[model samples]
Target: MTEVAGSSNSNNLLLEQFKDICAVDTEIARRFLTESNWNLEAAVHLYFHANDPEAIQNDDNARNEHEIRRRNVANPRNEAPANQNAVVRRSSESQLDTWGAWFRALLALPFRLAYFSLREIFLFIYALFGGNALAITNPREDLQKFLTAIANYPNSERINWFNGTYNEVLNEAKSSVRFLLVYLHNPSHQSTETFLDKVLFNKIFSDFVRDNNIIMWGTDVRTNEGYKVATSLHELTYPCLSLICLRENRMACVLRINGMHEITPVLTALQTALAENQRFLNAILHERAQRELDNRLRREQEQEYQIALEQDRAKLNERRRLESERQDAERLAREEEENLLIKKQHLAEIRERLRAELTNELAVKGGETIRISVRFPSGAKFDKIFGVDDSLEKLFNSVLVHATCPDDFSLVSSYPRVHLQCAPDWYREFSSVEENFGGTKTFRQAGLENSLVVLVRDNDA
Candidate 1:
């Protein structure tokens, strides 16, 4: 049987080798996406967040479509709709209408910007239950026009009456309204006693009404309850925000007018509109916050899943390493056992060759030849040695082939002191050797120490 090798440390060596390979694989996996795009490649990473095989497939298709669209257009933002891109013809009338709409929108920029800013601040402050200055800005031409139109209504007498007893009506405006009313009245009539009377209570009453409406009225008086009281457009230039709401049947406007006075039905209507605006804004913000929270939770879950998967992979790799090492160890152990069996078999063969001489010694002066024997060729020392059995076989074969003359047989050193147990086969082989040499020798004549024997085959023989 062939001897096996590498019994002691091969398992450890194999584990070390596998660790090197796994480290390389991990490093490559980590950088794979970055190498392809030269960027973070977050999309590639996020693809794993779908949490379902089907969603992953659908997301891939969508991403591909987006990529195609982006690549087709030199400037993606400028790409018109598919249908619009095909239509190069248009009637002059249609073109004129389009141009007119564009022009109107362009002209409305200033008003839109002002209104939007006011709307946002109005909503924010209203949410916090505080006053805002957006609606209180310099007079808007749109608001002015609306006020002028309202003043021209047949209800002019009613507006005048409402403005006449401003202090008295302030109490009525607050009673049944669910929201505050903003009063944005013109400041053209500053000298009138009625307007002045209403103007006097502006600050005291600005906080009076909790209804959700802004009612803007006209009167030059700059300080009056429930009224934006001002001496001139320049004096009214100081912006102030107010809240207003109307009572049922729209008979009264509750005012939360702040820092301004001069009452009007128009201001009353504005207050109601502003309150509704604030409610809508609150709804949108709340919805947006909920969506953001949901997104964050989803991201956290995805990250946890990824981390778990990586940990599982690491454990799996570790198990593989352990298994590999175990196999290596088992293999080495089996090899060592096989090599030991072979060595025992070789020793049995040597003992069989020495048996006859050993039996003869028993007859002469001993009971049995029971000793351990070792053999080596001439020029081979016992000390500086390794691989004893295999080297002995090689040296024995070399001497049999090349040393045919006595002069060719070089005797260097031999340890004849080693002992052996001689079986029957040993007696038979030794008998043949003595007969072939035309001589016989006693075991004592061989001269041994510690009952150890070293045999040297005749090179020529």
Candidate 2:
């Protein structure tokens, strides 16, 4: 079941491809390809061959027969039996039509002759007045070809015509800031030749057209381009003239003159239209200029706003940078204070250990030891035995190392209140210590032995 369904889908896709290639209806393509045993090449070959003349003729004959049968079935009246009387009626009607055609032609002969005579007279008058008859008859030619033919005609150089498309002429008029005169000609019209010869070709009118900054675009109504313009502008007469100008960025017809008119009135109408539309064009230019100025001001304001925003951002970044530096400085100061406190605590522990060891050594040498009582800033007291041989500098170093505020202190004898300078190098020599405290006096003489009270005071006090 699956295989069968898949094959069916593949065949459908192939049929669509064949339809696209041949540009034929899907059903017909499928039927023909199926008849060719699903062979694409054979189906295409048969399809083209079937379009041969004899095959097409046979197909047409078959279709006609089928249409006849269908009509007979649809209308019972068409299916009626044919008779000899009906055949005779059809033959008589054919003969009557043949006679009626001949009689109508004969009756119209005089009117036809009069029409041709009038046309010939018109042509003769046109030639006498230096107009070209051939040019009038071939009005459907291209604009350039038509204009060139007119220029080659007898005395056609008297009229100065602008040679360009309608749009091209309008653009030129806009660039020069002038008005455009568009003339649509219908050469087939009876009055066309007379109007051209008498008004357009006159010396005064031609010179006026040439001297003015106005552009003139001419077209024949019979040409495709001319017909389109005429229909769009709703022109209803031959030899129509329009004065067009650019106003508010669009082409506007200021005035239109239809049918025959004298040269003086046409020129007056053109001049009036130009004057009115020129004011409108000036107003448009003024409005455009004001709008441009407003746009420039708006752009400048936006640029200033952008600059202000950038400056504010820069100031904020600088403020943040200063704040970060202050925080780092505070953090470094705190770290240094903590490290100094830890160093002082470590020195006190080492001093306590050294004091205990020196006291034990002096106690073991009983007679050779000297005992001293020391008081701390916290009012704590301890007794230590020191060898008389121990330098005074060792005693001062131990006191300083144990002091909480070691950098700001002095030691004094409580009774005399004498300040002591414990210089490390000088007091480390036994002879210096002996000279300052023991040389002039023995242990009992200077009252310096045994135990003594000492006070620690702040250096500032």
Candidate 3:
């Protein structure tokens, strides 16, 4: 119930505005506004242009067609019959008035030609000065020249004119979604002075226009640009006000108040028209703002998502690197342990073999026995008996069987302190040595006497 009452109040407000703007009865305004889906702007646009007084002179059949359509809506059950009757009536009217219309058009042809000639001239001028595809002259200069003629008087109230050509002002109005108030002034006409003095320069009218944010633009009809617009509008009046607004994606004439008028009526006309159409501008503003906000929000979200994705990917990669390093360390530790076990087992085998060979060599304890003492770095001593003809290899093998012997060592003589190359690889440190520098020499063959003590040195230590 509240929604319906609110809707009713809204409709009533729309009807009042439409009647005031179109200067129609309440019933007429209600009917037009309803036909236009309660859109004041569209409804007002339709009422003015459809029932244009100038249109009534040129093509009155259009008004008849509109009336028929309006009646068709009120009595929908009789629509087909009404359409048939309309078709018959139109056929009769065409047949009866064809010759008269043709003759009238023939008479109007010369006037139309003159009008078209001026229109073409203005179009060429606009192409040059109105920021066309290629502008040849400065539009600001042209507008200034036009405004200079109007502001020639000292006491004149100057309107804040748009500093551009008609084409530029139209484009601006469309872009800004504002009403373009176009005044085409004819200097020779009687109404021009009245319009300028009473309406155009009136404080109330100016204030209303300023408050409504209407773009004021004017040019003399004698000028090429203005002449072009005048011819295009087909207005015969001296002082013409063309109220143009952005409608259906194009700047179109919403209402035109022509000839002489007082300030109040002019202000009322402008106000009603603006009230009828400003909703379109508001809607456009809202839509653009909404689209911008949506785009901004989407961009922000995308940036955040990308940032989060990068952070997660970085964390995952770090974890993988740590896990890989841990696994590698564990593998290396296991390999090192296995290698140590194998080395220990190999050393035990070598010790057992060395003991067996040493026992065999020392068992022959008969001829020319030489006893040598080996002193280790840890102060451990090993006294081994070898035959005087036994090779130094027997001494090294006997030392190896002892648990205190180092894995890699060279024997040094105790009294002489000479490094004896008894080990197989001991000569590797020398650039040149005797051919029999290794363990191939026997203890007696080498100059070693009985009970010679040698020191066992560890190579790594």
Kindly report which residue stretches of model 3 are placed more than 4 angstroms away from their true locations once superposed.
Answer: 1-141, 154-158, 231-236, 316-461
Better model by TM-score: candidate 1 vs candidate 3? 3
TM-score of 2: 0.38
Worst 10 residues of 1 by lDDT: 85-94
**Per-residue lDDT of model 1, residues 53-110, tens digit only:** 2222334443443333223222223233442221111111112124544665466456
TM-score, cand. 3: 0.50
Cα-based TM-score, every candidate = 0.26, 0.38, 0.50
Ranking of predictions according to TM-score:
3, 2, 1
Model 3 agreement with the true structure over 1-461: per-residue lDDT tens digits = 01222378898888766654544456566656655678776675556433333322323433553454333223222222332221111011222224553555566466556655765687688777754532334545656767888886333454688888888899999888889988887766544677687878877777777887889998776666666777676654456788888877777786666555566655665665677778887888788799889999999999999999999999999999999999999999999888767666776787897787766752755688877888998899977777888778777767777889876566789887877656544433321334344546777777775778989887768
The number of the candidate with the highest TM-score is 3
Error of 2 at 375 (Å): 20
* Overall local distance difference test of candidate 3: 0.66
Q: What is the RMSD of candidate 1?
A: 37.6
Candidate 3's displacement at residue 345, Å, is 13
lDDT of 1: 0.36
Could you tell me which residue pairs clash in candidate 2? Answer: none
Best by lDDT: 3
